[model samples]
Target: MKFATTVLLTSAIWTTSALAAPRAGFGVPPKAPGDKNGALAAEQSTSADIEYGYNWAGVIHTTPPATGTYTAASATFTVPEPTATDDSSGGKQGASAWVGIDGGTYRNAILQAGVDFYVEGGTKNYDAWYEWYPAYSNDFNLSISAGDIVIVKVVSSSPSQGVAILENESSGQSATQTLSADPSTATLGGQNVEWMVEDYQSGSSDVALVNFNKVKFTGVQAETSDGQKIGTDGATIYDIQQNGDVLTNVTIISDTEFDVSYEAAQ
Candidate 1:
């Protein structure tokens, strides 16, 4: 499998440099709690609304039909084992699955959390993490493996303060951490919510994407400040693209669920 190095910037307000690297202090991995069942179960939904864009393949809900002080967003999906490719530049190859609030309208900040799957020199690495943009992401100590059912979530009390949670249902391991938005940047709009499978990129270098085949996000739901549970009624879907061509196919399974299939377009 081959992966493209250049990606189209989907957001006009945010530049590639700003979203490229994980900042130094943004993502603080949570301490692993003892293996336990009965973690907070995410709400399950059977329907979802779908729309489509570039560089991102998933669902995005903005304010209009679903508007308010968006407090939290969550999604559950299995970690995919991407097919590794040799990078002529000797870089890693992989992708990330995450759910984040804000970054659609307001460009400067996003409160997000997820897991990463990448290959380096023939070895595949899986790590769970959380990040508040402009700072580097922090990794959790919990063991991660392909096919593990992972549920990730981000919740904000306000625009600047939030907590990220990750749970591996298959392993019974979990991590949680508190974070503040970048102090130097503007506050998060708390307007847009997203569940995405991203081609992991770091510090201006494109990590060779792994062919994860197909990843499906289920049990999707978000909450507004006023306490309204919003579904994917009018959410917009985006496709990750290299140049002007699409690389992934996003299909809405229901009003609150969707699937992303990788095309391995390089």
Candidate 2:
């Protein structure tokens, strides 16, 4: 990743949409609406529960330690869909969510419990793998050793003490991050979740957000960059290919809270 000598802890505990972060959709595929509460939704729930059971981790030193000089590059984000998400939601509907990952080799990744809340119904899932391109070129340097993962959470920002952690395999280095807002009681489709990228090595990071307004599955209008009206199907998802296609473990913490973990194959 590129070094931004100055690093700020962009830990703004505010609830907004998914697209709220920067460069969240540089060259990735645009996500259209998917099924309201279809099979994909069930898969998300099942996947999230399984993925949260155990922490995803790996070690990089085993592959090959930096020999001559230590160099790093920011992984390219080039998938058709957004890296993290607050899926199709609207003025009156439940919550939807998704997660995708790029390439990387790690020792351990864990989903720590945070604040708790209650919700009627919603779905969430995660995907991990390598991509041909990174999210932003100028933001970080690209290298074979570096990689990125995607995490998506859909829920009301009910005040809870929940956070997730990603640990470096070789160095045992790790970073603790908050997933959503800290509110007491929140209604489904009423709040937004912001996806973030933090550099554990230097503590610098960039943020992207998708607000509640951006999430709409059916009977609503969506605006593209060209200003064309589009109907959201709320079902389409990106695919994972080759040596990296895998689903993380998940565990349900409560009706509204849960844990998810996944690893990007090296």
TM-scores of the models, in the order given? 0.80, 0.21
Q: Residues 1-266, candidate 1: write the lDDT tens digits.
A: 11221222333312222232344422222122111111111222344433233346687775633446778999899998867654335557777778988765554677888877877777888878777775556777689899999988899987778899999999999989988866655467777888888774555566656777888999899888878887666676666655434668777877778888988555
Question: Highest lDDT among the candidates is held by which one?
Answer: 1
Considering summed lDDT, which 10 consecutive residues are worst modelled in model 1? 32-41
Flag regions of model 1 displaced more than 4 Å: 1-15, 18-54, 64-67, 85-91, 184-186
Clash counts for all predictions: 17, 61
lDDT (C-alpha, whole model) for all candidates: 0.67, 0.20
lDDT of 1: 0.67
